[model samples]
Target: MTADTSVRFREFKMPDVGEGLTEAEILSWYVKPGDTVTDGQVVCEVETAKAAVELPIPYDGVVHELRFGEGTTVDVGTSIITIDVAPGSGPAEEPAAAEPPAASVPTPTAPAEEAEEKPKGRQPVLVGYGVAESSTKRRPRKQAAPSPEQSAAAAIQAEMNGHGAAPAAPQDRTRPLAKPPVRKLAKDLGIDLATVTPTGPDGIITREDVHAAAAPAPAPAAEAVPAPAPAPEAALVTAGARETRVPIKGVRKATAAAMVGSAFTAPHVTEFVTVDVTRTMKLVEELKADKDMAGLRVNPLLLIAKALLVAIRRNPEVNAAWDEAAQEIVLKHYVNLGIAAATPRGLIVPNIKDAQDKTLPELASALGDLVATAREGKTTPAAMQGGTVTITNVGVFGVDTGTPILNPGESAILAVGAIKLQPWVHKGKIKPRQVTTLALSFDHRLVDGELGSKVLADIAAVLEQPKRLITWA
Candidate 1:
């Protein structure tokens, strides 16, 4: 074969993947330079706005190089991997040519076709489509040979001698049976997986088992590290002049400016209310089993969302925004409920549009969809706009409550707290009940204390007796 026909260097560029996302953060590199890879082999993992995706290589060849390092943000259409492709030859190279753009390259062979045609048990290259299709034709089943008991005396004697020969030295049976990744996790967590009883199927060690075994033992005060020593004469090179700088970029910069603007310009006032949400917790449990709410994530946030919508109807002032230029309170008839989700990127408050129009089941589904999309980083800019009020679920992070800063153009924000079972007075008898705290922060100029309290109390009352939601509706 001619040189051009024998070998070709195929460049694999990062695709949009989906959701029209322009950029992604490189989470990891599965292959490095000089590593031989096959089509459909996973080359790296990229974190998009919505989810972590494993990017597969599109060609069969040795990985020439990874253009971007882990944690580096790369734009779509950037060349991520180069593969030296050769026909028949195990490894080969070709003379350099002017690089072609990613869009000009033809689609590589599908992973399913390659898998069925390739030899059994061979690891495929990183390039190409993922997930091979199953074969349609089934091979004929094989029959086993007759047992030694059915054979002659000489055959029985031979079998007995084979069994008696050393017995495989009692192979290290104490060591746990785990995959390489699980074993790596155990090592990283300082866990002795062998000693940790396996709960996985077939007595295999799992990631959770490793984590549980590696849990740090609580220590007394005596074992705690002491405070750092005072600075020495040489270390005090510039006393009272020490400073550290951090670049304000991405989420940190955006959050900082928003916090400052909200605090200084919005005239904020925060009020706290503790509520017995036992009924709400019980209702959540019931909804989780409900056929109507199937596949929806039933949680306190859903109830809180419903309560907030109801309270907004009762006290519309809480949802009203301050219009400085117009010198008016922009009262919204419909609620666009904003949910503040803390993602890998930072604090992103994406909202549900016209949330007041949704029923309980519809709201639950919307919340589920919203959360799933947000976590995957697929929440559109339009979904994040026109929010009248917001709810920040600090409870997910185990925080009891915090005074949340208002999203720009919104009037109020609510912080949901962690729910815990605590002893409470029920009809003069002490009973264990699920309780939670709610912190409401509002622009004082638009919302008075009476209005804020009423809004909060209305939400608490619904949570205290979730059945009230039906009656209130």
Candidate 2:
């Protein structure tokens, strides 16, 4: 029942951006110490295991401190920024021991064993956060005595100082000034910012400082550390020049894991069909000029999406997920149709919810918006969730067909290959026609070979004879 007399500061702890995600790396900070922040203002951007999210400050205050620099991975419920809320307070006069502002809700009484409460002034969290355990509670640390090596170093330093040798004054170890890119480089290399010797003007930490810290430590006593003998012309090490390494994280990491799980867990059966889409191509041009579809995206993908939707309606079993835990097939009545879009970060399939209910124009609009958002790296986690079926157009890349893997959880994914004018027999005569190959890969556990073949055939039939869409719908 005692009142908190410490400096009033609101500690903005990291939230669970996605279900059960424990940590996120700070991408960039929009606010720094001495900057004023308002309620619901985006203070920083963070990249979680799933997606990049902008965290909004929940209350109005002046930023007292940024607990961790950009690129640091902070755990959920851990304070990342402290903001002073008192009317006259400022970052310039921030208290040495600025505690988090306590909650107005009273601490409930509990048994003696559970009486120890969490540290006061902890940031409020959503219900998804796991209950704090004993290990989560901060404990005081007792300093350990120096070891023999450290004692010897101290003696040597004292002897040198007694002889008028200048002592190295401890450098300021407050927040280090570095760009986010430089900080990320340091983090990736496992270099500690505090240990790095800065050479940049204004004492700011630079990318060179971080990389220099990661360089091999100098050899002690050239005599003791013998250099390796030079390699002969036959034993060269130029393999590194031809190879490149990229850190797999974010979308790439998630996609890799999902694809591996899907490939091994699901019994995949892919069926390929080559179709003449000359009629479908003509329809695409017609729809583009239609007033109803004006300002809406009109493309083969849109009609292909509609065709798939119709096929799903005819064979609802194709739009299902294999629930391994439940030992059942979950047939989704509503389709969240995912379109695989490849971005610089990686490939992501963001779906349009209840796509079956959307008319051609509406579906086109949603697809256009989804693609644009994904290209700009602004797609939300919700947009990528609960996908029932997916379409991947490898055709755009000028590649002929590919046996595309089924997206995780989804029963089927259709890959559209490049459409080219190829000689084909029409009405018993060889003529140049728009031809493309479509490959539909599905999980055999949920979709049988007969069902997968029917779905693939349905899509091809609809594309070959565009009038089937009107008749089928």
Candidate 3:
């Protein structure tokens, strides 16, 4: 075979590993050009806003080309890799294959528009045979053959001396081209897409461009501006010997945006309580020995989570959200308890759905699975949605307490602080007891001081007397 033998090239578009996620950063490639790969081999790892996932090749093939490099954020449905399915037996080439382009292929436009017409059965999926009808996928909605008014005018003009009416000009010159995810980000940040300058491959407004637009143009030396998520840092730390600027992306970016929105939009009120949790700590040990709880994760966090659930049952009004659009206070009948976990990437709150329905042992098992999945960087975006309340255990970091910020949309969040043996008044006597601080932050718009205080007090009461879990629950 000739060295220049050509074969069929299959382009693999970036899959939406997380449902509806528009873009992902190409972390690394496992195979280079000409490398042999099996059908199920993982070709690359990409980080979506929710989590990092390994993408596997769907068929046996030889790597042909990589369209994007590491650290580049590519939109879903955009080709990221190409493969040669028939390596040795060269396929017939196009008649004009000998000719080359004058320059690089025109940077592709955002594919989100035409994708709306595609049926779900035909679109590319994570782990299956993708119907490879990609060549005709970019078809635009055909305009009904030119209106009759134009045809009549064309006949009159042809009679006057013109052969036919001049073709109508293309109608899409003014629309700003942006992927769906970028557009969603713009909407969330209250940015006008057309006003933002384009820095993407083909005049497409990217997520970064939208963030920059939010910050606005730079000012003179005397003035500075506070930028939003995924934008450059306002101030740099220059004191260190070696400075490394890591561009914020993925989970960290989403967390920053949520925190900023929650901080500014919600009316926050916090209350703190210090309590003796010695009996609760002792119960943890006892549960560990129970055969029903054997092999499950029995830790301080497990009990804390159960206590918060019990409190929610006692004070149901605290488990609610403020809906700005409908201008209503939405109370949740079920609890999706969010656990704020610190991982290598950043802070992610993956909540347990219908947590109130679980038994103590079941909750412990679920908690173990959630933490393990998070630590492995495998938490799906679905696991992080629809949380009714949250518990942030800052105790693991040895901090006393904090005015914890309420998770966006949720009315309340409980911050569990470090547990220490401190001198306390136990039954009218000073004694060393296992004591801890609990801070509860709530949305004042929905949860008043009385309701927030009741919820926090209930949790503290349950910890003080472990028997309350049976009565209150």
TM-score of each model, in listed order = 0.54, 0.71, 0.67
Q: Predict model 2's lDDT versus the native.
A: 0.74
lDDT of 3 at 284: 93
RMSD in angstroms, candidate 1?
16.3
Tens-digit lDDT track for model 2 on 223-249? Answer: 110112432444232333464355566
Clash pairs (backbone) in predicted model 2: none
lDDT per model, in order?
A: 0.69, 0.74, 0.74
Top candidate on TM-score is 2
User: Roughly what TM-score does model 1 have, to 2 decimal places?
Assistant: 0.54
Sorted on lDDT, best first, the list reads 3, 2, 1
Better of 1 and 2 by lDDT: 2
Candidate order (TM-score): 2, 3, 1
Per-residue accuracy of model 3 over 178-255 as CA lDDT, tens digit each:
654465466445465656799976576788898888775422111011112233344332333264455788989988
- lDDT, candidate 1, 1-473, per-residue tens: 44462237677778886546687766556654445667787777776554456777878765544555544567888776667675334323322344554553332211222212222332322223332322222122245875665456655566687864232432242224564456546544435554677887657677888777756562111101111243244422232346533334444456678788989999889999989998888889999999998888788899999998888888877888888999998888888999998865567788898999999999998999899887765565557668889999888888899998999889899999999888999889999999899999999999999999999999999999888788988
Cα distance off (Å), candidate 3, residue 262: 0.6
